[model samples]
Structure formats: structure tokens, C-alpha cells
Target: MNDVIRAPLAFRNQHEILNMHHLIIGAGPAAVTAAEHLRKLDPNCRITMLAAEGVPPYSRMALPYFLVGDIEPEGCYLRKREGHFEAQGIDVIYGRASSLDTVAKTVTLLGGDMLNYDKLLIATGSTATRPPIDGIDLDKVYNCWSLADAHRIIESTNEGSRVVLMGAGFIGCIILEALANRKVDLTVIEMEERMVSRMTNAPMGDMIKAWCEGKGIRVMTSTQVTSLADDAGVLKVSTAAGDTLDADVVICATGVRANTHWLDGSGINMDAGIVVDDCMATSAPDVYAAGDVAQGRDLSTGDYEVQAIQPTAVEHGKLAARNMINGNATPRGGTINMNVLDTVGLISTSFGLWMGVEGGETAEFSRPDRFEYLNLQFKDDVLVGASSLGMTQHVGVLRGLIQTGAPLGKWKDILLVQPNRINEAYLASAQSQHAALAAA
Candidate 1:
């Protein structure tokens, strides 16, 4: 025989009440936007945002400009003022979420407290990945990912300081511009054959390399940094090509990795990132993930890919919030994956997969003396991708063409006849969907 404890009539309403607490696990743009959206949908809902970083979220994309002193600390902030999130009915917890209990629907904070919630959103962004090199933990070796890292580099920089930057990606190029502006002896070492190799094609890479060199920044390609040693007060960086460079500081801009360690043992599907469906829902019920941590589908390749850009993150947050509030809304379409690196005076923009050698034929126009190059890649008689260096006026047209999978018939003729004539029939057909949206 078992005795059962029943709830009293007065306490019966507790079981029927819905717990509308929304717990967001990050403080970056994605999490912040998601909180705002949730608040708009349900003003009385309990919204708690957990951030591993102590300070509130700031514009990390502007960190290079901040390092160059082009923008002050206050200008880099995304929030207009302090307590702005609080005014929006968001409770921010400045502590790392150590673990997740999916069964209990609770997040375990570092301080031995568990937050139970009806719905949870994992928007923990990414962290800079430091290469596994000897002496990488030296005091002078730094990674420019956070606001603190930017401050460290800015404080350590000087007129005659020799700074060795490892990796020549977008961030690396921006750092080169920032350091060169300070008149520092800047040397960039990249493992790739050319600068921004992963992002841009060969022609665009050459144009950017020339631009960097024109600004007195030494761009070293096909090189790998093997080790870093603190020689007295100076930092000695050894490269794989048997070359060594001395520097006052070493900035590693290799790349970033998804911050998903908290999901370990939480029964969430993760492969390099949190695996979410089209609606940004996790394997566990009522749990969602977005931003850099969520490996969403890529439109160009139709495969799950991690897009760590800010705009994609913001859009993902908005879409996730809509799906959460509306029960099951259609997932938003993926972005075309565009990157614009405005370093010094050079404006380099690359869209989609512009370097698929086997699947496409490339049509290029280059004015080496003018420092302008454009490469258009076509596959199956459709414009698949495009890259523009030192010229961006035609980027919008190219993006529209790529997004709509516009046919490449007579494309070369149109491009040669009047490059600015993007309002022609083919281009108009490519932008019909956008036109429809605008009309609506």
C-alpha cells in the first residue's frame, strides 16, 4: 500500500500555470537581439541572459578600429548606455554557465546555482583559436578576439614596436592597417599561399596584397609560425620556412571556434557546433540555439555551416525568437555569405563560393595599374559567385545575381557592354523576389 500526497485545492493553480521564463545563454548580439524580440512578444515573460564575459556585449567587429584609436572605447559599445538591457526587462547574469541539465531544464552556473526555465536559447558565440605552438602562452603573444585583447594590443603598441601578426585573414588585414597607422614595424605571416586565401580568389588576393604592401606593411605568404620565444624583453617568432622575426608583440588571428563546451553531456547534438533544425530548435524539447554556436544551413552549398558574422547572428536570433513565440514558424532563408574587409583604403568584398575550380568557369577583369579586379564564377550556366577588389559599386548587383541563381546566358556580353547595367532583364529576373518583398 502507498500513500499519495495530493495538492490542496488552493495550490492546484500552480500545476496549471505556465512558466514562461526564457533563459538566453550569451550576451553577444544574437542573445541581446533575441532577448529584445522575446520581450516584444511577451512583455511579462521572465527573461534572463547569462554571459560568460563580465562586461556587457560590445561590437567586436569594430575592435580593429578601436585598436587603431579611430574610435574611442565608448564608441565601440553596442549599447547606448549602461542598464539599457535592464530597462528592456532583461535580467543579465554575468557568470559562465558551466553545464546544462536537459532533463531538469536547468542551467548550472559557475557559482553552484541552477536556473530552471521553460525555454532556453544557447547563443554562446565563438572564441579565437590559438595555434598549438610552443611559447604561445607567452605574455607578448595575444589573440585579438575580445575588447580586453584590443586594449592589451593598444597599450603595448608604440612607434618603433615590431609586431608579428600570424594569419592574414580579414581580422589579420585589419590589424595590419591599425598597426601600420601607428607606424609600427608590422610583419604579417600567413600559412596560405596568398593573403585572405580562404575568403578571396587569387586575383583579388594579389590586389589586396599589393594594397597592403603599398601601405608599407610587409605581407609574408606561404609561411607558418612554428614557435615564439621571449628573448629577454623581445619576442622571437620562428616560422616554418626557417625564418625568424623579432617583435614586441605577436597577434594571432588564426580563426575562431564555436563556444559549445557547456553542452557536453547535455544530450544535445553537436558537430563542431550546436546542431539545430531549420527552426533553430535543439534535440531537447523547448531548447533552441542560434548565432555562431548554431551550425545553420548554408544556402550556397545546402549544407550545415557555421557563419560567424554579426549580421547572420542577428538574423538567426530574430528567426529563432519568432519560431519560439509562434509555435513553429518557417525558418528564415540563409544568407549568401558575404564578407567586406575595409582595410586602409582597400575595399575587398567576396560573395558565395567563388573558388570552386572544378564546378565552374571564371570570367575575370583586371586593371592591375588601377588596383581593381573582378572575378565572376559561373556553374551550370548560372552565376554562382563573385569577388571584387578595390571596387564595390557592383557588389549589390552581383549579390542579387548570386542569390537568385541567375542564368549566365549573355552575362559576359551584359557585363562587358555596361557593367553598371544591373537593371537589365537578367539582373531584373534575379531580383524579382526582392522586388516582390519591397512591393509588399
Candidate 2:
């Protein structure tokens, strides 16, 4: 009788192993995209997503529009349809992963629930970096990252409110425009030498600073907030430059760090982020990482780096999902360094290695009077990178040319003389390539 009972239990355990489970630990675009693809590829597989925020998956990029009153909170949802996740059979569990056990293939949530998986994806994304400063924890000071934070900001801020924005990096600059729309007395402070120092060159940064000033927004570069204090029911922001400003709200957009703390001692190789191969697989077996958490290859530089941009995230998700199901059949092309900024009415963009590589040539044109500029970087006759200000016409062409790595032949010389003729060059180069292909 004992042997008969043991045989039945053993058979049930084997059946459970046959049913595959794909567990994703995030709720961002990458996470949702991967889940959807996984279901499409393997209809019978068990798909579960761990949403740490305990809310419906929403786009952080859309939060600014929410702040500007352009969209309702529901509009921020990645899938606005009712029962979207349910209809797709993707189970979303509202729990934060506290620890990962790669060998056991289990993740422990904060509430002490251990979930097992046949395969795992780490798409935990990132969190806003908060600098250590006195009174940094004071009331009304918040990082406008999540839905909860957005609610606090909306409640604390109003028209004519005194708002002090810290850091003028990519995230900060994005939030700046929404604040400006709120008609608040806004002041932007950056520790870098110029605005968006990492993404834009000196001339472009200066132009943005000047443009913001012209719009009546006080732009302070090379300035850092030293501390914050409560001043008669208002917030006091003290800067490193010996200046203090009183504010109704202090918005900290300092920076962001990858959400990889839970993977410590999990034997996963990580630099600034989890190092991923061409297939988006991590060092551990049966484990993958994607989106902002995975530092993969840069197509232009051929280096592994975290792009943290939406395009990169979405691409990473699709590639990761395909490879997960198809056994490394879909390797990533690479993640491009890309940014498109809209500061008030001025538009600026950068692609790939915008800050020219060594021994590379460049073609540039600028009309500071009209606040328009274009700079193109090249290696031999191929366009490698580009930057532009207040010009929308050449965006699609510039990206297409650089991404395709088209040989310009004589077009390179023409661009050096008249970089403004990028449109013509693109058309000619494309026609020539088509002709060559037809002849071949």
C-alpha cells in the first residue's frame, strides 16, 4: 500500500515539471511586452508578472503628460483596455521581490511568499536616486516618478506655486516642461556645467539654457542643492553656490540607479547593470534580463551599456521574449543611444555617438539667430551619429542614414560643404543603394 501511494505522488510531480512557467519580475513596458510575446509563442505556458508597485502597469514617460493635465491617470496604463492582462492569461501578482534564488529557481516576495518558475526575467527597471541632504525627507519634497508621487505633486503644486527643480539632466529637463506648463514660478538647478551635459554638447546645452531663460525660467547650471529645510511652512532649498530659495515644492530629479539590489549574491554578473549577451540571457542559466536593468550592446560603439530609453526597452523586450521561446534564435541588433527633447517649443535630438568618435569627421551647420542647428559625425563616408536643434525635418532621415550605415560616396563631401542638404543626400544615397541592389 505504501509503495502504491508513493508511485502516484511521483507521477504528479513529473507532470508538474512538464508544464513550463515563465515568471517576469516587473510591470513596465519591457515586462508587459515580454509577457505578451511569451503567451503568443507558447499558448499553454504559465505566464506570471510580479508587479512590485501593486498597481496596473503604467508608462513613466507618460507621467509628465499627466502632470500637465494632458491625460487621466488611466491613460498612463500600458494597456488601457479592461481585463487586458486577464484576457491575455498573464497573471499579475502585486508583490515586491525581496530576494532571488537562481539555483532553486525561486523568487521570495517581501511578504515571504516563495514563487517557483521554470524560467525567469528580471525587468525590475530603476528607481530615482535621492541624494543625502539635510531636510531631504521633509514634507512636500518628492521625486515625480510613480503614480503615487504624481498625486503628491499635483496636490502640493498649483498655479503660481514656487517650484524648485533640482538637476537638469534628461529626466529633470522633461519634468521642466510640464512644470512650465503649470504656470509655476519655476527655477531649474543642475550640478553639471550645462543643461543635459551627458546627452548634449556644450553649444546645444548653452542654447537650451538660453532658451529656457528667454521663456522666463531661471536656469542655473553648475549648481547643486546642498540642503532643504522647513521655513515658516514653506520649503527652503540651499544650494552649493551659497544661495537659498524658498519653494512651495522641491522636485528632486537627481538621477536613477538600476533596481538590482535583490540580485546580490545570486551569482549574476553585473556591471552598472546586469550584463546580457546578444540573446539577452544573463550569466545564470534559464535566466534573462531586459529593459533598463540589462546593459546590452550599443550598435554604434559595440559596447555594453544601459540606455534606459523607451525604444531600447521595447526592443530589448521583444528580442528577449523571442530568444526565450525560440532558443536564442532572435539576438539583439543592439541598443542605440537616442534622445529627443522638447523644451517648450524648441526641439533637440541626439542619436548614437553624437559626440564624434576619434579620427572621425564631422559636418555642422548652425543658425543661432533662429535657434536652429545641425551637427553630423561620420566615420569614413558613413554617418555614425547626429545632433540637431529646432529642426524636425531631418530627424527621420538622419536616423535612417546612420542606422542603415549607408555609404555616402561623394555625398560626404557635399554634406561637409552644405550640411543643410541632408535631405537631398539621404534621397540620393537611398536611390543609389536601390539601383545597386537592382543591378546585383
Candidate 3:
């Protein structure tokens, strides 16, 4: 951490004397993970979790599965057993944080209730972004973010229901299968030139778009939704291309923004998200941030960035919790920017700097006819990034090679020539590194 005055201790624990009022904001994966870890660290710590949603702490990612009828509402919960939080001595309060007073060590809720804490964790995750479109606030327009949104989508969406999805980003693509499962008259609008333009390369994105279209989805790329109009109960979607489409429901899968507006005057540093050190500690003393709301380190770039994936959120929460009790004991090395999307039956994945860093070399192999593509990015002798489509077997190895930063040495040259030899390269590089470490 930073040089600052250490807060006074309320009591002494087995390891150290410390204040035990560990309060966590948000009820997503990060919040739940931190709360559980906090309990395991300090059984007697006064742990309270503030939830913006009225329902139980559940996985937002599971909302798509719920929409597909693969799982019920209960399956979306972080803790399934009755009184799980209570049994673990964790208090879950439903409220949105309105303001924060770092000096007073208190957080004011939207309902005007002030909660004081000795150690606070701001895991307040991201909120779904709503684009500036006319009639976007209409009754049928919903962002598939919360459980409530899922329920509304389930109720409104029926067989052959005309659903216009506004955005072909990761979140939008995730719910594509569920929407397809409903067999609705689907149309996906993307402002980019191809699907998942942010995550994958143009070729891979185009392949995904083609696959979706093959599945009977109307995919419109390089298109913009100009406005929306209410046609009685139907939604009239107007695009910048001067096209009007009738939709029963408009699912706004635009994107998400960090939930850090409340901390504006709180003096906490923020850049894209609440900036945090390796210890997950923010600029404020005794306050930490994690998950989508925290701008942590990216392993590939060594720069602070907000990784809104569930895996990163879990890691952030765990590390933040450990550091909270042990005083910045566990420093987060960095998080690999990765995303795996299952668009209908086709799978696409990207790891680390998938777009390839400046001065980096890239090896590509595309077989569009067979719906297969692979791109490997290398910097020096290290595998820094990779992207693959319809190649599920190498997903784990690709992620491992990028994350481990194993020196490929000669394998780098070999991979450049034969990109499909990723498995061999991973094994050779990892084994060499392991052998070297063992000898050391």
C-alpha cells in the first residue's frame, strides 16, 4: 500500500489487532466472494453487504440461462441454501449507496441511512448502459441485466415474437442463444463492422456473424439504431440506415458502465473505474475496490483496466478480501483480459491482448469454409495473446500459454509457421519452464 495512518483497532484477533467492521457494497459475484472470504478470515467481524437489488445476491451472468429456461430463478442465486448468509454471519442489506464520507468511514444509502464501517469494500459492479435513443424508456424496452429484466423478457417473449436486439457485443451475444431458443423473429443490430468487434479480430467477428445468420438470425452490422417509437404495444425500431422494423420487445444489450458515480465527491481516485493498487486498495484508507467497478492491472499491458468478466471479478473479490483482513498481504499480480462466448452452437474465445500489441508478431490461420479460425500473437519468445473460433480443444492451452507467459523460445518460430501446433508449443514451453524452476 500507500503511506498513511493505519486505522485504530477495535479489538485484537488471533493474528493482529484490527477494526472488524468489514462492510461490502454490491451483491454480485465480487460482493458475495468477498463476504464469504471475509467471514472465513474473521468470524467475529461485523460483516454487512449492501445490495442495490431487492432480490437475493445472484449471478448476473446466469440471467441468460434463466431466460433460456435452463435454470429457474433460484438457480441464479449465489447462495442456494436457506439462511446461507445468516449462518455465515453475513448481513445482506438491500440498498443503493448514495454517498460516501471517507473521513467519517460512513456510507449513506439512497434511503438516507448512514452505515459506518471500519473497513469497506466497494464491489459495486457495473450497470447496463442505455443508449440515447428516442422512446428507449418505453415499456417494452428492457436491458437484460437484472433478474427483473429476465422475468419481463420471459413473459413478453413468446414463440415467433418479434424481438429486436440493439447491440451485438458480448452481453448481447451471450443472450443470443436464449433468444434463439425462444424461436423469436430475431434481429441483431451492431454499430461495429462485425460481431464482437471489441473482443475478436475482424475475420473471427465476421465468422460469428455468418454463423448467427445461418441460424436464421437477422444480423445487421455497421448499423445504428437511430430511434424507437411506440406502435401501440409494438416497438417501432428506426435505424440510421433509414429502415423501420416492427418489434414486440426491444432488448437493449448496449453495454455497461462502472457504478462509481456515488463516489464522485468522496475523493476516491477513478479512471474508467475506481483506480486501485495491486492490493486492491483504493486511494482512500481502509477502503478497497474490486470487480467491474475497480480498474486493476492488466497482465499483458501492465496497465490498470476494468475487466468485467466473472473470473476476474472472483479473483478481485478474493484478493481484496484477503488484503482487507491481513493488511495488503496478497497483492494481485494482474488479470488476463479474456472472454469466451458461445454464440448458439459456435464458440469463440479471446485471451490477453487479442488484437496484438504494437511491435508484436501475429500468426493467423483461417478456414472460413470449415468455420475455423485461429490467431496467435507473440512478443519476443512469449505468447501474449490469442483468438480462436470453433476450436474448443485449445481454449485452455491458449489461455494458459498467454497467462503463464511461458518462454516458447524455438516454439515461437514453429508456431508462426504452424499455428495449429499451439498444444505442442504450450506443453513444450510449460514443461521447460517447470523443469528450469525445479532445477533452480
TM-score per candidate, in order? Answer: 0.90, 0.92, 0.92
Q: Write the per-residue lDDT of candidate 1 for residues 327-404, one digit (tens) a residue.
A: 757575565677888867788877887775475776677887888777777776677777777776656777777777
Q: lDDT tens digits, residues 32-124, model 2? A: 999999988987777788888767899998998898899999989999898788777787777888888899999988867888988899999
TM for candidate 3 is 0.92
Clash counts for all predictions:
0, 0, 0
lDDT comparison, 1 vs 2, better candidate: 2
Q: How close is candidate 1 to the true structure, as a TM-score?
A: 0.90
Regarding TM-score, does 1 or 3 come out ahead?
3
Clashes of 3: 0
In Å, residue 99's CA in model 2 sits off its true spot by 0.7
The lDDT ranking, best first, is 3, 2, 1
Inter-residue clash pairs, candidate 1: none
lDDT of predicted model 3 = 0.88
Q: Write the per-residue lDDT of candidate 3 for residues 243-266, one digit (tens) a residue.
A: 999999999998999999999899
